[model samples]
Target: MEGLTVKRAYHQHCGLAAAMDVLGERWTLLLVRELLLGPRRYSELLADLPGLGTNLLADRLRFLVARGVVRQCGVGSAQRYAYELTDTGHGLRPVLLELTRWGLFRPELSTVDTVRPRWAFLAVEALAAGRHAEVDEDYEFRVDGEVFHLSVRAGRAHGGLGPAQPPSVVATTDAGTLLVVCAQPTALTEATHAGRLELTGTDSAVRRCTALLTPS
Candidate 1:
C-alpha cells in the first residue's frame, strides 16, 4: 500500500459519493481506461502508463479488484497473471468515451501536442463510437513506430494493442498527423502523397478506413 492515498469517505447516502468512494482515488479511472481494451499484465500496465509509480499502480489495481471492477487471471504459456476489467468495469466504456471526446474537443482545454500510442488507440475508438456509422473492418494503424489494431463493426469500434487479422487497411503516421487529420478533413491521397501517411489497400478501402480515425 506504499504510495496509496486514502481519502475519507463522504459518509453520505448518495450514489455520487459512493462512486467517489470507489473511483475518486488518483489514477483509478485511468486504470479503467487501460483495461477497457482487454486484460493486461502488471508489467504491461506499468509500461504503457507513464508517470504512474509502481507502488501506486499496484495499490490502484488492488483497490479496483476489491471493488469488483477488475479481476486477475492467468495468461500466456509462462502462466503469469494479468488484470482485466470485470463486466461492471467494462460498462464504464461510454463514460470514458464521453470524457475523451470532451477533452479532445473542448476549446477551453489546452491542446496536447504529444500523446502515448495506446492513448491514440482509445481516441480512435471514441471517435468511431461518436460516428454512429454502419461499417465493419479491421484496421492496422502504425503510429510513430508502435502498431495498433482497430476494428469497427456494426457501427461500433473495438480494438487493442498488437497486430490482428490482416487489416482491411494499414495507415502509417504519427500521433500528431492523426490529430490534425481528425480535426480537419485531409484527403487520404494527399496525406499519402505528402509522405506523411503511408496507406495500403484499395483506394476505397483506405478511404473508408481513414474515416474511422477522423473525429466526429
Candidate 2:
C-alpha cells in the first residue's frame, strides 16, 4: 500500500469530538458570532473583531463557506461580498448563548476591559426569557457607535443589528456603561439621571423597553 498523509481528527467517535471537528478551529466560533447579527463585509468583521489578523479571518471565512456553515453574497450593485451564516451556522446561537452566559456569570472569566457593543445582543437574549409585553415596543440601543434594535410584542422578543424605525425608545451610551445599566437597577437609574446614558421616549415607553431588555 502507498503511504498517504491525512489531517488529524479527534477520532474518538463521540459527539463532543464531532462538534470540535466543526468548531474547534481558532476563530471559527467568533467569526460565527460576528455574522450572527446579519451579513457582514470583510472589512466590517475586521473592524468589529479586534486582534484578528486579515489572513486568518479570510481563511476562516473560506473554511466556513466550504463547510456550508456560511455563504457569500453580493451586496447591491457595488458587487461587494458579504458573509452571512447559513442555517447550520445560525443554529449555533443557543450554544454560543450558553457559553456567553457561562462567561458572564463567572467574574474571573470576564473582564470589563473587553466589552463590545455586539455583546448586548447576548445580554438581551439572555434576559428576555421572562419579559412581559402587551403591545409591540421597539427600542434602538446605541453602544459605542454601533446600533442595535430590540423589540417586544405579545410577550415575545425580537432583535437585530442596526437602527429601528421610529423606535419606541432610543438609548445611547458607551458599551461599558450600557452593561452596567443593563445589569444593575441602581446604575440604570443613576445613569439616566446623570446623563451617562441618554434615552429618548415617553417615560412609560422607556420604562417598559428597559424592563424588557435589561439583563436579569
Candidate 3:
C-alpha cells in the first residue's frame, strides 16, 4: 500500500491567507459582517450570533484583534467593548457582498427572509458616508410587521432599543418584494403594478433607502 503524501498547507503571514486565518470560521465571518454594519457590544454580538458560545466567541474575537482585523474600543458605564474593523477588515467587504448576492439566489425558497444582509446594509451606508461616519447617526427600517432600529454613534451601529424619533423615511413592502427591489434595477412602481410590491409612507424616503440598499 502506498502512503499518501500531504501537501504542506502554509499560508503567507501578510496576505489573504492571513486575512482568512482571522475571519475564515463560520461565526467569525458573521462577526465581521456585524461589525462592518457598525460597532456592537458583547451582548449585541451574542444576540446576532445566537449560535455562538461565550468561550468560542471570545476566542474568535481575540484572534481577529491579534490579526488587526478588528479593534476593541471603550463604551459607557458598563465599560462594554465595541468592535470595529481595521483597514484590513474593510477589505473583506467585497467578499461579503458577493456571498450575499449568491445567497439571494436560492431557487428552492419562495421568498427572502428579510433578515437584512449585513454586507448590503454596510455597503449602502458606505455609499452615503465614509467609514468613520457610519455610526454618527441613528437609522431605522420598517417592513411588513417588523422594524429594525440602528443606534449609531461615532461611526458604529448598535442594535439595542432606540429613542423616540421619526425615521428619515419609511419604506413599506413585503420581504420578498423588497428583496427583488434591492437585488435588481426594478422600479418600485413597476413592482407594485405587478402586484409584487405593496407600499405606503414617504415615497422619496423609501426610494432613498432603496437606492442605497440595492447593489445594482
**Highest lDDT among the candidates is held by which one?**
1
Q: Write model 3 residue lDDT over 65-93, tens digit each, in one string.
A: 77688898877788777888888887787
Candidate 3 or 2, higher lDDT: 2
Query: Considering lDDT, where higher is better, how would the candidates rank from best to worst?
Result: 1, 2, 3
lDDT of 3 at 55: 78
Q: Candidate 2 clashing pairs?
A: none
Candidate 3, backbone clash total: 4
What would the TM-scores of all predictions be?
0.81, 0.80, 0.57
What tens-digit string does per-residue lDDT give for candidate 1 at 136-183?
A: 788888888988887788888777777758898887887765655555
For residue 175, give model 3's deviation from the true position in Å.
5.7
Error of 2 at 123 (Å): 2.6
Cα error, residue 17 of model 3, in Å, equals 3.1
Give per-candidate clash totals.
0, 0, 4
User: When superposed on Cα atoms, how far off is each prediction in RMSD?
Assistant: 3.5, 4.2, 8.3
Full ranking by TM-score? 1, 2, 3
Looking at model 3, the pairs that clash are 39-157, 135-153, 135-155, 135-156
Task: Compare candidates 1 and 2 on lDDT and give the better one.
Answer: 1
